[model samples]
Target: MNFNKIAAITITGTVLTSTGATLAQTTYEGDEFMGYASTGEAVVVTSISGYFYGDYSEYRDFTYTIGNDYIEGTALCAGGGTKWIAEGYGEYEAQSEATLNMVRFVCEYEGELQ
Candidate 1:
């Protein structure tokens, strides 16, 4: 019987046991993390529009017009629902010789905010 062989076998078994213990602990921690994430707020898709008429993920027929005082717009949302009456503002850089501007808007469903 070789002492070296016995020592090597013992060491291998110890390493494998330690690795298994670590893996079990990590798995438990991962499950706990997933449970916490699931409880948080999530966006639910209320409905899908343009199911058969068109692509449900694409917005179409969007139109906007700018006036001196206000900006008005309307669009067919991907869910097939119509989104209109978006309110937004524009930022202009007067110092820049080139045209530089940005517009941002928030749309309400059915033109109403709940």
Candidate 2:
């Protein structure tokens, strides 16, 4: 991957609840990492399904989930030959089951990754 490419990602969604339908929208920016992967802000669409919208298989393809996501020790930053994370974390309603969290990762690279 070219480390010099900077991208902005956005996500939008809503939650199905008893009280009423809830809407959620979040955007994140990639923080530059001089010579490594960039950091990003959290935009959780929901607890489990919201965070990863691209494809669950994609993460499973490229990541190793340690344990319950959100738990600091349970989740490890994956990708690249080394593990790195965005500048932010995903935000979800722990007690709310009908909520959706959308998370976007903005990657700001510096050098080429080969």
Candidate 3:
């Protein structure tokens, strides 16, 4: 029947539209810092040498298949040490700027002497 065919087409179109929206990609970039702390230290760690600093950037292409409320994508860093990774969590954010937040730790290395 004509009514049945039209109903099926409508449902199909709605499904496709929603799928495309959820699969959309977003990118974010900001300064990043990488560092480690002692397990037994009770003192607050606040020194320039304590942490290696740099820029953090990433591309969130799709939702992670195995996790809840998580996304996976490529990540990059720039500054004293340059590094890249194929897959990383998209929910890392140390400080918020605009609509995106700065990644906490994408890569780690010894910073150059000033």
Rank order (by TM-score, best first)? 3, 1, 2
Q: Pick the candidate with the highest lDDT.
A: 3
Query: For candidate 1, which ten residues in a row score worst on lDDT?
Result: 25-34
lDDT of 1 by residue, 1-114 (tens): 212211111211332232111111000000001011122322121211111121223232222322222233333334323233243633222222111111111111212113
When 1 and 3 are scored with TM-score, the better candidate is: 3
Tens-digit per-residue lDDT, 1-114, candidate 2? 223323223243333333322222233333212221122323221112112222111121111121223322112213321222322444222122111111112111212223
lDDT of 3 by residue, 2-65 (tens): 1121111121133223221122122223223223222221211111111111122322222222
> What is the lDDT of every predicted structure here?
0.21, 0.23, 0.24
TM-score of each: 0.18, 0.16, 0.19
Which runs in model 2 stand beyond 4 Å of their true positions?
Answer: 13-46, 49-57, 60-114
Candidate 2 TM-score versus the reference = 0.16
Which regions of candidate 1 fall more than 4 Å away from where they truly are? 1-54, 61-76, 85-114
Error of 2 at 98 (Å): 20
The total of clashing pairs for model 1 equals 2
Candidate 1, residue 39: how far the Cα is off, in Å: 42
**lDDT against true structure, model 1:** 0.21
